[model samples]
Target: MFFKLRKPIFLLLSIPAIALVYIFLRNLSGYSINYQVSSPCACYKCLTDSDPWFNYNISENEFNWWKRLQTESRSFGVYGTTVANFFKIFPRNPDVIQPKPDHCRTCAVVGNSGNLRRSHYGPLIDLHEVVIRMNTGITRGFEKDVGNKTTHRVMYPESAVAVDDNTHFVPFPFKIQDFEWLINASTTGFTGRSYMPVKSKIKTNKDLVMVVNPAFMKYVHEVWLGNKGRYPSTGFMALILALHICDEVNVFGYGADSDGNRSHYWEILTNKGLRTGVHPGSYEYNIIQQLDQQQKIKFYEGLTKKM
Candidate 1:
């Protein structure tokens, strides 16, 4: 009985001793015992439920609904003529958005709000794994405030800009013609007319082009915005896309500037009274603040100085 009790006691005592020795050895080798913990997303389920890109697995109901969305004078063809051709050139699946366990993917969604004019967030923004910029937002003169690095550039045809070879050129298609336009722009040149003066041809690598899913746009309009405005603004859509793809998201250049005027960071405002034409600006601003309050994102309010 004594021998049996002694063996059990010795085994139990050796376990902690072995653990201590292992820790000591790790410390001696300049290795920290710290484990990386990922930040939990509060709305993960909601964000992941809908696929953000058009893929082969898209259900019939979703495809039908997305087809009927009218932007300008065009809608998707009933038999998916443009869509089938689109996948032949562009990738149906976006591999860039895949998440990894060992890596914490941080993203910065940069908008064109004038608030970013003097707010020096360039270095901080560049530190993120993914930096998403939209519309005519430029980094040439304002590289100090807005980082020169860009992972993704989101734009409609009217708001398109030339992106470098490394950056992913994401087109936000509002109508069916937009899909056809992307294919044309990459090949011959998009010479079609629109509500605004669109670039006749865009200069960028075609392989990196990723078109946003129409179903995702409908999801943003109905689920996220509760059918507010004509459709979600490009900036808001970029933010929503970041929320889904990124482990952590930082929002920059949103809302009115310190002067409370709606303007672009790179624009000289001739009309300081200009407001969002079709978007629900006030409602969108409120949702941004609410997300900030909930700790879902880190919202940087730029430039407190009155201009």
Candidate 2:
């Protein structure tokens, strides 16, 4: 009778003691559910030990990478801020997004190689919110290839060509003296390398230069050369940049025609005997086809099919 009564009392005492010891050990261990506390770090990396400065008023539990991605995703097509700042110093004015519309913003990108002189796609190409062309090859003749709807023209401070003042002009400030050197070079009436002087001073009436994102450029090179196993050219990068910045990107006069003939769209004689100009290699073309298949952008080939 005495042993049976002691057994019931010992069992009751053992249950609470075990629970206390387990609680003590859990508090001691870092990974224990009852021990490891919430972190203060704002970066998305979790399961880390570093204690960052956490906002006391903000809800610690609410912060996460998913939340940040969602926020950043909304601001998706904006180009590099670093590139935009370079042009801020010269001709302090707002940059115009061409084919200017109140509701939808569209761009038509034109390349200079004399290929666009008479393609007659100019009026149709003008249907965009903005029309972007590089260098100064705009004329009414090659309307098909160059597109007559030139809204924005990109130029270097050192371009060896002249662009009409009435149209919107964009200067690419790639280097430190891009604005100063190019502007000075043009002002001083000295044509050096890739720049030509204007006859007279014209009013600066254009938006900021559209800058190439270094990160985006790296992404393109990596995707093409390192990942896709090919070298990407300047025009290929330009197309990629348009795809990233604009909502709807349409490519015209890029690469050779449908028959794999190596010819210049600009028709500038590069010694038809010596070397045929090339835009993209077969591997880069494959990557572009992949991008098109993924519906990342739309590519239209203005081919005569006579090759």
Candidate 3:
């Protein structure tokens, strides 16, 4: 009886030991098996590696293509007048704002998922050469998890927030008025307001403001995302932008949180089913997972099993 009992006891203890080892190895790999997903198509590799991922120096032919698409696509009603005004406001391409780095650039694209609440990823995020945050993601109270540094803040008129003089304010214009707003905001303190009525005068330095080409937004939706959703969310567009500019990209606070709720890290909601209506959240998440598996980008899920 003693011999039989000893063997069972050893087997019970070994089970927990094996579980611990599995968790340790998963953490060491910096990716969780839970998030792994296969790509929708094999062409994904070729698409991601293709040239002109961004509108760095958009050629005349590309401009014509974008204009033709704008006329056909009903998602965004970018008028001819707006396109002309956009050109006048921003004659130079996005390359003008790009920094000439002597060495490889490592970028961190920080989203606002609830998973980042107590992640202690602030230090790691700040270590990157370029840090890109979006919309109204605050750091004053959540610095311990989200980091305080901001090299770039990507937003549209509706989600615009004031950045410091040092930080770059990248405006993603969706309408003609948005282009007008940027120019007026920089020059005349923006008396006119949009339908949403954004801040008339932001505190950010005028010279640091960079406007993303509406064409680039179209490229992200059509080419990169394969028109998965109504349109690519700001966070998704920002990720592609980082991939173009940075040598290596690391994503944080994207997808659902620990409990699988679609919510921001700054605010948690009880409704797990809540998701962005306009954006294809599930499809986008799958693509992100595929990119991680392909080693094209690193997706930091935030808080490994140890935490």
lDDT of 2 at 279: 27
Number of the candidate with higher TM-score, 2 or 3: 3
Clash pairs of candidate 3?
113-265, 114-265
Rank candidates by TM-score, best first.
1, 3, 2
| TM-score per candidate | 0.78, 0.52, 0.70
| By lDDT: ranked, best first | 1, 3, 2
lDDT of 2 by residue, 150-251 (tens): 655655554524444555554433332343344444444333332344323323333332323222323344433443433244555555445323445665
RMSD, each candidate, Å?
16.3, 22.4, 16.7
Candidate 1 on 1-307: residue-level lDDT in tens?
Answer: 0000000000000111111000011111111112123323332311221112212333356455655555343332432656677767766545465555545678899999989988999999999889999988999999999989899999988888889898989887767678767778888888887778887777877677766666566666665577888778899989877865676789999989877889889988889888887788878877887777766678997973343
Alpha-carbon lDDT, every model = 0.67, 0.39, 0.62
Candidate 2, superposed: residue stretches over 4 Å from native: 1-102, 112-120, 155-160, 165-168, 171-179, 186-208, 211-216, 223-232, 258-262, 266-270, 273-281, 304-307
Candidate 2 vs candidate 3: the lDDT winner is 3
The backbone clash count of each candidate, in order, is 0, 30, 2
How well does model 2 score by local distance difference test? 0.39
- Cα deviation of 225 in candidate 2 (Å)? 4.5
> Per-residue lDDT for 261 in model 2?
47
